[model samples]
Target: MLLCLDIGNTNIKAGIFEGEELIAHWRFSTQRHRLADEYAALFLNLFALNGIRLRDIRGCAVACVVPPLRVVFEEMIQRYLGVNPLIVGPGIKTGIRLAVENPREVGADRVANAVATFRRYGGPAIAIAFGTATVFDVISREGEYLGGAIAPGIIVAAEALVTAAAQLYQVELIRPPRAIGRNTIQAMQSGLILGFASMVEGMIQRLQAELEEPARVIATGGLADTIAQEVRSIQVVDPHLTLHGLRFLYELNRRR
Candidate 1:
């Protein structure tokens, strides 16, 4: 069995895989100040609930965007799980070429997404992760990471708006009944949800235009389902894309 983790700015998604089958998975809020023992306790409790023991974990892989949490999880895994987890970063064997300007600057989560997308669906492909920052990662037809765009996530935009504006408060990020909002809440919803959907559509068109060919679009992250619900361009809403990517990379790069 392998333990795979995709640590993002907003959440830490962990999965326990028995062979290729993901047996158990869970998500926890990202707490930077949390101790290794504290994280271990929370996960071990989750493992117990799922009937997975610590020793059941043979190997581990991680794709962490938060640098501090990388070291923290490394320590936690070493102390509790007793495996030297493969932390995805530069020099990892992803089996996918990165054609970007600075591959080092690419997020591990993005690399994992690229590897998983190519392995599972092949390219050309676009993976949108709607987390702290809504990220778009493009994979070429040749299975290369071709880089994409980043935009403020809807929650971030909403929070910023609420902070800046005196009267507007946060509203549920659901699609408005109509584009022409009748009320303040409806207006905010229209701008946040429907507006993001339009951005997604336009971005897909622009990216597809640059590719000069149609590419499959997949989405992940906490808010992926919300945005994908309104966007017609998204073909798949795979919440665990990054986890599967970690699992695949573990098999590829683990010591023989």
Candidate 2:
């Protein structure tokens, strides 16, 4: 089985694939301070619960944004699975060409998303990841990784709003009945959820206009379902896009 991990700022998305088929997947909150042993224990428990044997894992692939956790997973995988994980980075054999000014500045998760987006949905395409930061990754018709925009994510914006305002407090991130809410919670919900939805719509138009060609837009990440429903421009939302991409990349660079 192949273990593919998409480690983000807020959460770590993991998938266990038997060949090309994903058999099991799980999400764990990102803990940067966790040791290699701790991570291994967590995975062991998950594997046991899923009826997977520790020795059954043949290979592992990772797309990690947290720099500190890189070595942590690397150590865990090497010791537990006895496999050198194919970490998504500069030397990886992803087919997409990065056309940005500073390609190194791009995150591994974004790269995986682009690879999966173009491979699964072809290009010109746009992938919007609604995570800690709302990221927009654009791909050209020829499958080049053209850069996109970034904005404050829904949760980040909402938290900031609440923190900055003394009277405001945290509310459930759900859609309000009306755009103009009658109550405090509803109003906050409308402003955070609907407001981000509107922002997504506007950004799609702006990106499409700049691209000069009609691009297929897709959404992913935790908050994708929450906000995607409100945006007409987004028609596809594959939460496992990054995981799929990591698997694809691992297949490409697997030792012969």
Candidate 3:
């Protein structure tokens, strides 16, 4: 079995794959202060609950954005699982050609998403990941990793609105019954959810215009399904895109 981890700013997503089949997966809040032993114990409990043992995992791959947590997981995997995880960064064999200014500046999670997108859906394609920050990664028809845009995540935007405004408080992120909001809560929801849906559609239009080619827009990350349901441009929502990408990358660079 292969254990794949995608450590993002907001959450840590993990998957256990038996061959190419993802047998189990879980998500947990990201705590930078957590120690290696603590993480190991938590992972052990999760694995036990899923009827998996540490010894069953032959290899591990990670795509981590949090530097501190990345080191913690690396240490935990080495000590507990007895496997040195394949970190997705410089020197990893990602089969896509990065057409960005500095390839190293690209986040590992974004790279994973690109790899999975091009491999699974082919290019021209766009992947919108709604995580700590909503990121749009574009792939050319030739399978090149063309850089895209980034915007404030839905939660981040909502928090900022609440923080800045004196009267407005945080509200649940659900679509309002109508675009013309009836109350304060509905107004906030409409502005956050429906506004973001429009933003996504507009961005897709702009990207397609710039690319001069039609591309399939795929959404991922925690709130993908939520936003995707409102956006017409988003064709597919694969929450496990990053996980599958890590597995694909691991396969590409697995020790022979």
lDDT of each: 0.91, 0.93, 0.95
lDDT tens digits by residue: candidate 1, 1-256: 8999999888889998999998899998899999899998999889889888888889999999999998999999999988999999998888999998899999999999999999988999999988889889999999999999999988889999999999999898887899989999999999999998899899999999999999999999888888888888999999899999999999999754
User: Compared with the true structure, what per-residue lDDT tens digits does model 3 show for residues 143-250?
Assistant: 999999999999999999999999999999988999999999999999999999999999999999999989999999888999999998899999999999999999
For this target, which candidate reaches the highest lDDT against the unseen true structure? Answer: 3
Query: What shift in Å separates residue 151 of candidate 2 from its native position after superposition?
Result: 1.0
Clashes of each: 0, 0, 0
Q: In model 1, which runs have C-alpha deviations exceeding 4 angstroms? A: none
The C-alpha local distance difference test score for the whole of candidate 2 amounts to 0.93
How does each model score on TM-score?
0.98, 0.98, 0.98
How much lDDT does candidate 3 score?
0.95
Cα misplacement distance, residue 22 of candidate 2 (Å): 1.4
By lDDT, the better pick of 1 and 2 is 2
